[model samples]
Target: MKQLVKFTTGIILLLTASINGFSQDLHFSQFFNSPLTTNPANTGFIPDGNYRLGVNYRDQWSSIPVPYKTMSAFGDAQLFRDQLTYGWVGIGAVILRDVAGAGNLTSTKGYASIAYHQLMGNSSLLSLGFNAGSANKRVDVTKLVFGDQWNGKFFDAQVPTAEPMASSSANYFDLQVGMNYAYFPTDDIYINAGASVQHVNMPRETFYDGDNRVPRRYIGFLNASLKMSDKVILNPGAYYTRQAHTSQTMFGMNAAYNLSGDGNQQAYGGIYYRTNDAAMFMVGYQLSSVKLMFSYDATTSSLSAANSSRGAYEIGIIYTGLYKNRAFSDAIRSTFCPSF
Candidate 1:
């Protein structure tokens, strides 16, 4: 049993390194909550409010000895709604941090984003946006145990692993751009779609000596909000992303039921599937301007055996508000979208 545990630990460490060093990017089961990380065009795409703020936290692989953790905070707001004749501007910023594995590899990123939204007609809207950011990754090499350190029966830390490690940290700049389109046929139905490209610069990102550039990541998503009745709303969404040779696809649906009748209080629940990876379940609540959500991912892949099907859990909180002194008479109001 001891040997089996060691083997599992080693495999998890390798997987962590591969995830951080290769094609896969950090992700969350609650993708919709992390709007800025999903696409830059979502920076200021609030449909029911003038400003928004959100935070997300995730812990993964807790069944293992070492767990991976990620966190993010973001805020965005719409501007010039009273001055612009046909369009408005949006500006926002996001900060993200992650720590992984026994080596305690840490990554931090920050971005500033802007977008422009134009009203095409009474029922349609168009948006375009871009973001620029910087990222830094560092790891503690001493805590890592190499294969060469094994001495038949056990591993020896005193043994020097003949590996040429050039540096302990790396930094790079990143850029992304995206566009969104929304159509509301009536006051009860809304449809939206968007696509974005990340790592537009393909900047170098490696601790070693060679030129290892980050691959361009392409993402696309579609979602709809349907009001079934005055007391219920249904939301269905699909997402797809590709980076280098790897890709991910997800499909999900969420339902909101009004508890206060006036839409000030609501209960939310949803289920999602990530291709062949995992199945996620979510529960949430909204009170006035604040919404809180919790989700859990259950492993469905081959790795489930090592972790007993326990994958990850996440928490998300969001707040939306309007300017107290601003007049809503001339503002473009989206009665079809969810208000929180």
Candidate 2:
């Protein structure tokens, strides 16, 4: 039974990689927390603070013999806030790592991003940004068993598998560009929309000797924040992305309730649905300058049968703060953005 499970898992991984021509890019169910990965234009688009830092972790397919794990860390800050008369520059960096399957196929990526945000009157803002990164993927070929290795009754490691074995690693450079627009009708209401394109350079990524290039991924998102009262705020958002022949769409709403009345403490809860995929439940809390969030994905697709609906779980931690010398009132007075 153990051998069968491992074999089945290996086959599934092989099929998925073959279909995509490479391993699928790592993503988090709490897409909103990983802003830099979602859109380069979000770099330093901080509304509530001058600078922000965050980290995220995800574990998937725990029911399988070998699970997939992913983690990321990122930080961004607004620059030239006092130097630029009409616009300010934002800079940020992010690092991501992922490992999958018994073969230990691992991927690591790092990116540096920058964006310029211009105030359009007192109610609107516009941003344009880009990022450059390096991606590397490696797998332990020795640990993987090919179909030809099967010896009828049981797989024999001693038997030679005549596969077109290439190098066990691949590396490439990646690029992305994005734009954002925001409108704040009043302090109580804010709306934002953005679109981005990943793999703008169509970098080649392959382990074999053939010429295969990563396809461009297009993403668009819209979100809004409405402050219903001093004690409550509502946030609703939608995200869509397409890469090659596959696409995904997700929509959800989360609300924050002020527990301290002074906005220093709050509680958050929400639900999100991924079309034909999974339903995500989220809960979070905020204290002063830090926020912690947790989410779980319950599989709704056919794959649920194998895993018994045990999908994935994720955790996110974010911190936002102003410079020690900077006055809170001054920061609020300089921008016309909504507070969440």
Candidate 3:
């Protein structure tokens, strides 16, 4: 476990050194479940509902001794439930944490989202949204020993390595903005498109100082849901992101089919491909108001050379509640609404 942590930590630092910026962020294969991270416009944007709460977790690089772990929990509430024509106001909050490597390099983030959704038509809605958050990163430098600390023929933990650092921890405020268009032409046909800019504040994040900070992340995504029949639904989506000189594009679809005659139970599966990254597979089952999903990714990029195609594993859980207004219909609904 110790060796694995050291190796991954070194890899991240080396990558950032090459880019000349303390860069790179965490993500998951199960993107759909991570509504806030994907787009702030999704805040409280639940169709046929007034509130929603969900959580997601990921464990990656288990092929190694020390694995990376991430988890998040979020909640959303939409107001103006009775007046469909006047539109609605949605608000949400999310908190997340990630830990990796032996240094226990940890990142903690909390964000609030606010959006104004204007009713465009009986079945369409347009939303403008914004998100504000604080991100804190911390590391125990003592856990790592640089080569400079090594003697001529051996390594000594007591030796002092001549390295300069401003601090072992950093905290920064981040801002993000987004817009989305959702069209529910019919109960069976639903589509949405959105764009967002994350880290708009560009707060400094380097432990060594200077202007190096969180770079603005630009993202664009589109998704559609088609109910092919009473028993089956097809969902397709594409996502694109750019930051600094690095960019990633992912595209895929999931097909869900009712397993029971009443359409209350479903079994679904899908595959997604991340350009130059890895291929991901997801499988899930929905029972009433609760849905649980699992996804895994295998490296398809050059990084596979060392890890032998090993990648990440993720899990997600979601629950949605129905609102009094029936202006928009959700293709599927979960019966479990927990009040905790």
Model 3 clashing residue pairs (backbone): 288-334, 288-335, 289-334, 289-335
For model 3, the run of ten residues with the poorest summed lDDT: 331-340
Q: Write the per-residue lDDT of candidate 2 for residues 208-251, one digit (tens) a residue.
A: 88888888999999988899988889989999998888888999
Runs in model 1 with CA error above 4 Å? 2-21, 328-331, 334-340
> Per-residue CA lDDT of candidate 3, range 284-309, in tens?
99887678999888888765654567
Name model 2 segments beyond 4 Å from true.
Answer: 1-23, 325-337
User: Per-candidate RMSD vs. true structure?
Assistant: 2.2, 2.7, 4.8
Candidates in order have lDDT scores of: 0.87, 0.86, 0.79
Q: Comparing candidate 2 with candidate 3, which one achieves the higher lDDT?
A: 2
Error of 2 at 17 (Å): 7.6
Kindly list the per-residue Cα lDDT of model 1 for residues 1-340, writing each as its tens digit: 9769756764775585477546567888888888888888887788778899999999998877778899999999989877777678999999999998878989999999999988887788899999999999999999987789999989787899976779989999999999999888777888999999999999998878999998999999999999899888998999999999888999999999999989999999999999978999999999999999999999897667667778899999999887767644354563438532
Alpha-carbon TM-score of each model against the true structure = 0.94, 0.93, 0.88
The candidate 2 region of ten consecutive residues with least summed lDDT is 326-335
